[model samples]
Target: MQNERATDTQAALGTDTAPAGIYIHVPFCRAKCPYCDFYSVTDSDRIPNFVDALLKELKRRRGRVPSADTVYFGGGTPSILTPGQIERILGAVHDAFNMMPDSEVTLEVNPGTVSLDSLHGFRNAGINRLNIGLQSTNDRTLGFLGRIHTAEQARNTYRWARQAGFDNVGLDLIYGIPGQSREAWRAELADVTRLKSEHLSCYTLTLEPGTPLADRVNQGRIPSPDEAVVGDLFVFTCKWLDDHGYRQYEISNFARQDPGKGIDLRSRHNRKYWNFVPYLGFGPAAHSFLDQCRWWNHRNLAAYLADVAAGRLPVAEKERLTRDQQLIEAIYLGLRQTDGIDTVDFRQRFAIDFFDYFRKAMVPLIDGGLIQLASRRVRLTAQGMRLLEHVADVFIQALE
Candidate 1:
């Protein structure tokens, strides 16, 4: 169901030439979460300075990018900024890039950082979509994740977002916490379905080596769930959300199933990356890609600000993708989506018959019921979805 619509959507994207997306990373948090690995600082004092730097950076890169149809304000907590600040940053973007009429302007808001009025102000500032991080519906689990707001606060925030006239909202949830019970995981899915948000991103909890969560597990202060149980949670969550009105688009993302309504549930900005459409990234530590050449800004706030103030791009590293590299990436990205790889489209783009190229290896996977090959499209089966990493590895080796 999602596959047909998504394929058509992807095709239609070329009609307008697909305006590129811009990712504005607001890298500040009230307090860092134990499991978060995103670059964020707690120095609220630097916000004023950082906001100015952001505008300068935006203006600096203005004419370099294509017209933008999506501007995503992802953050340490985008809601941490006042409406005036948000407006100023977006004002700079308007002065710089050509935003489409129906642009998907998304702001990632943490629970406690936004109030009713704050949400209203955000909407007025031209934010059409809200991606709220409602990590878990369980209070204890919320606290365990070092979240500032209780589950109730998250609920209220979602309510406020709706009341603020936001018809498009996305909720983010996580499963596979240290002691997360299967029943509790189901309950979280239940709560999310009840909200009936247009998009859902459910991720399994991972303990990065340097994160506090990983340290606790390594020190034996807390035990991470066994891998087998975590895998089960992943499969169950995917099936449960699909059973409800959410169909999996990406491995971790589901869009509300609405064929009649024709609702655009897929994240247009994120789709650009998966589809290899060009995008530009601003703010410290953010990355940008165009024509298969990718570069990222300095990760440190100080260096980023200094460079922008001095009228220079704070690019820390860059690389131009080889044809082989680009092909690998396209396959890697396509396999991560529920629609999987459209071999017909791949052949058109790369001028190679995808089926013949991978026939030897694909035969085994198909026999194992891990992948299904139609006339010109290949996708993972329900059981195959759980083992995507391994399946992708096989493709990567074949590409080599």
Candidate 2:
């Protein structure tokens, strides 16, 4: 039965007609952050075992994907692994998959976890892009977020990445902290733009359920994030980054474009997620989607490791989307990007008239200056992004 399913999935995935990506989730963290809900544990001792299990999984899933053009090492903190370990993993990836020669290999690094020499080693280990987690420029805010590194260390890490010959570097920042003012966020943007990294992702902090931050808010220890303030900061950031020569590609991602050189710095791996391109994720809590089916591994590290050790695919759940579910996701994911949904492509793919089907829902949104239907595409205006849920809900309800 499993062989039959694999045969059907392979037939559905096709022969690499479209670009695909690989995502490796490194689940070990130095310490768990209060606001972070992503699966990670403080078990530093298990790193070696985790790497071995990951390699075994990679070998087992060798022919699952035909080709990959992007490889992203995302994490609880991928840089916590030594450069030699990273090299060994990449070597295994090369042996197990058909990696493109010009693949955009990215590694997520947190400040203070990486040193200058180690950064150089990572570069030599085939990591061509670096995404540094510099959540804030304020020390107090960093402390509040339960981050292990200071503001200065984040800056030093960025500098060291450049010194290590990494030209394509991205930085992540968070705004909308409790009691944060619009002006404070503006200053934070000011500080980040000065670094002029190739890419910047500015996300508004969300108090995810079960996270320490959420507990603090629930217990009245910390004030909840102000939505209005976050909205203002979002607007300011869009305009600020635009004026600073950065193009907003996704809702939170801004890439610096050098028109003269034709350098587009948008994250290639992430585009797969938004565009429904085929990609596979490996690790605890990792989710994967190809064709109309999506599956995820066990979120628990022990379960994941045990399954891999037993030479079984560690997937915990799988779902083949119904047409309605696919349409809902198309709207939800399409609206997250600046490119929006291409009406022509939508009609061809799903045999539904994009504008006509959603006419009722798009009317109020378009009239309210929340979305724009132009150039054969439907995209959210800056205001719409602030109320993305409301906009998506309107479209989703119409589909229902």
Candidate 3:
């Protein structure tokens, strides 16, 4: 029954129009992080077959290929794929899609798995940007996070990436671990700054349900950090990064230099998500958004391959956004960036003044120092950014 429903959803959303971005999910990992719930398997026994299936699926969807400005290879660890496989997939992308000459192509890598040769191959394969998962510079915290790479390993990989001719490199870091301290967080930042990366994404560790971290908390095996401590750390992050010339472009993202200079670079692919630009996703657990509807491919790899091999679309679920839903999402997503929400664009898109549409909602947020309205634009204040989820809840309730 679920399969039938998924097929129906795919039929409804599938269309031949240019997309803003293309996202390919590589669902294979060397090891699954204890806190990760993303669909990925550690075993490499079926990797070759899976890659073949991915290529087949790409071919099947070629007719619907859209001009894309960005192509993102995100995964359990895209670096796990052999250079030859990566090359083949990229070749298929270029052949099928209308890619811009200066289009940003990115691959997510794990520092421990990356080598100079691999980085070079990825660049040769047309990957212009790399996002390395350097969750923490502290080995002890890294171990706690189930990350395989050490701080030195991450630094070495970053250096090699530069040598491999990748000017636009981004690093991912996480803070607010169970036993983390402000000084420790600062030291992590210090280590990251030395890399002089174009972009840096620092995130607070959340105990997601169904993950080992969450289980530990549930069983009283670990005590999660207090909310006050977490809040303090967030505030410290903003000030500290800014002081170091890493401006906060989004709530958790900081850039050291101009994006064009390979500093302060934004994730062009992810920006599509925040800006609600249309994108097409491929492979198992991939997602697509278009014509006000969102849909996802099957999470189960075997099922995805079987359906695709049979020349069937493997979509698993979808939703068509209502007018209210779209409006709410626009507010929620747009306000996440430091650039804030453009009132003119909102009016042009929805035929309503954003301020007028949600005067009541804006009033309290403004008073609470959570938002600022200026020149017909609205944006989250630093304090407001801290409580982004809470603000989103208020917006949702207002719609209700």
Candidate 4:
């Protein structure tokens, strides 16, 4: 059965030419956050080897490369790489693929890992955007979150990026952390708004099962924030950001001042994911979606390197989305954007009237103030946006 599934996935991969994005996974960090489950090693020695393997994989996948409009280096802390190393990897990208001239290239940086000089080096290396993790603005909350940088360090990094002439900067923040108060969260939001970032991503802390955070909660060493409080905080976030001139473009993301600029300034690389565009993800545990199939690299670093060394794709697993599955995905993905799902586009792609097909399912949500259909576009209301996962599930089940 597994072999059959793999064969099906491989067959699907050969069928279509999809829009492409590049995601380079930097699998090294100074220290792993306890809440993080993403694969990364603390040993710096592995980085050079990893970079070599990554470049090799790029060469091997060159034939499959499509013209890419966006390239993202996400990580265990991509900023941990030297400027030269980043430049080299990006150089390989240019060599292997036809990168669009106006491609939005983003590098993720941790507050502690970046300096003014490094930020300048990154810009010179062709990274057009910097996403700095500023999980919280309160020092105690920062320590509790196990972040290496203090609140001061985070603020300085943001300033440094701006001074370095990076106008397209993003700040990532987390709310609903254990022991974080409403007032504290409000203050954090205010501080971030003051930074006048081009983009902001706010996420509620989730205690993933089997993570250290989960273990602490189980042992009563830490308490989970009440769900009701977290829900309230989510609403507060949308209102606060919207009032401060940041538009909620997606459920977790907002942008500063200009709605036109905000709409134009979204992470083009990330938009591909929501649009179900094909992307090649390189590095251990990175997942790739191509044609109608998805495959993931081996989670084990050794296994991934061995496979790459042996001239085999380091894929650990693969799945081909069924037509029904694709339809469901389109509904969920389309609903995630602020522009929402377009009735015409849905019909054009799938030969189905999305509205007519899902009217029964959407009626209840609309009545409950969870969704709104305006100007032939369907989008989640502010209330519905807070329960996006639940709303997505309803739409998914309706496909059945």
Per-prediction CA RMSD (Å): 4.9, 4.1, 5.1, 3.9
Give lDDT tens digits, candidate 1, residues 341-376.
998787766666788788887988999998997767
Error of 2 at 170 (Å): 0.6
**Model 1, runs deviating above 4 Å:** 1-17
Where does the lowest 10-residue lDDT sum fall in candidate 3? 1-10
Task: Tell me the lDDT of candidate 4.
Answer: 0.84
- Candidate 3 residues lying further than 4 Å off, grouped into runs, are 1-19, 63-65, 259-264
The models' CA-based lDDT, in order, is: 0.86, 0.88, 0.82, 0.84
How badly does each model clash, as a count of residue pairs?
Answer: 0, 0, 3, 0
How far residue 237's Cα lies from its native spot in candidate 3, in Å, is 0.9
What is the overall TM-score of model 3 with all chains considered together?
0.92
TM-score of each candidate structure, all chains considered together:
0.95, 0.95, 0.92, 0.93
Instruction: List candidate 2 segments past 4 Å from native.
Output: 1-16
- RMSD of model 1, in Å? 4.9
Estimate the lDDT of model 2: 0.88
> Model 3, 1-400: lDDT tens per residue?
1111122223222222535788999999988898888888887888888888888877777746457788899988889988888899988887777888878888999998989999998899888999999998889998999998888998899999999999989899988888788998999888888778888898888888898888998999999867778888998999988888788888888877554655337787888887777788988899988777789999988999899888888899999876666667777887889888888877666666666667897789888999888787788888888898898787667655
Candidate 4 residues 293-328, lDDT tens each? Answer: 889998878888899999998899999887666666
Q: Which stretches in model 4 have alpha-carbon errors above 4 Å?
A: 1-19, 259-263
For candidate 3, the per-residue lDDT at 222 reads 91
Q: Among these predicted structures, which one has the highest TM-score?
A: 2
